[model samples]
Target: MLNPIDLHYEWFGVLWLEEENHFPIIVGYWFSKERSEITQDAILSGFSTWTEIGDHSMIMRMYQSIRNKQKKQDWEKRTRLSLRTIFNSPWNEVSPGLYLIKSRDTYPLHVSAILKKKFWVWLEHTAVCETKEELQAFMQRVHEEHQMEISMKNTKPKFL
Candidate 1:
């Protein structure tokens, strides 16, 4: 039986195979932040993958296969997101105060530049605020400084 601490967060959303109880497959999503109940039935309701462990030698093979597949899928998703961003926005410029952070490829340099001038420099990366107030302030600064209208499309990622 694998300890609960042994599991990783990336696999939290998916089902896991348990080696104990004759390789009984269990489906659950682990909430890492909370540590109250060790075994809760509510958290174990989901779909199950394969859970079959033969001997000690076969355990390694099953573990490796699951880990490899998860990593590959994660990498593919990131690559797709990156490509989408690049296709959407081919040109990007570095602003003076704020670093250009790419989220879905459209580099809102003008908006970011305005934020740097209006807000404290420390707030640039210290927090990724998704509230309406922060985004409105950022857009307002951009419009006032550069006379450019920030569109909703550019600010969707900041909130979502």
Candidate 2:
């Protein structure tokens, strides 16, 4: 099993790789205000405690500074929608098995994978992208290449 700390760092790295100057905002709308308040309090207290610890003060400071700076940036101030909202919006119903790749300097590219009826399968390989356009083009090229390879494999030589 993956440790929570490892997962958190991995997610942070991924977001940083995708957005040069921003961190993702994880939001959850709970039916219970008590739970929400409790969670927020815990986070704020945790931040405060970490700030006091001084061991990782530099990292905390850097993250806080970046958060403040991002809040001031025009693009950062805009309301960001969650992937669930984007994919399951009332206006459209996106098919499952779709994934998105985002880069620090580009838009998000949507990609799909083959899957069994309701089971999720992991990709044998991962895709890399430095930009949104690059990501989309990469996916397209990959699909085309795979198709050509499959065609060649399927075609048998004619015998006399």
CA lDDT of every candidate:
0.34, 0.30
Q: Note the clash tally of each candidate.
A: 1, 1
In angstroms, the error of model 2 at 119 is: 2.4
Residue-wise C-alpha lDDT for candidate 2, range 1-160, written one tens digit per residue: 1112111122111011224567534231112224345345545544322112223554345455553453234212223233334333321332333232222232322222221112222221233333557555655654554442211111111100
| Candidate 1: RMSD to truth | 15.4
Best by TM-score: 1
Error of 1 at 85 (Å): 5.2
User: Stretches of candidate 2 above 4 Å error?
Assistant: 1-117, 145-160
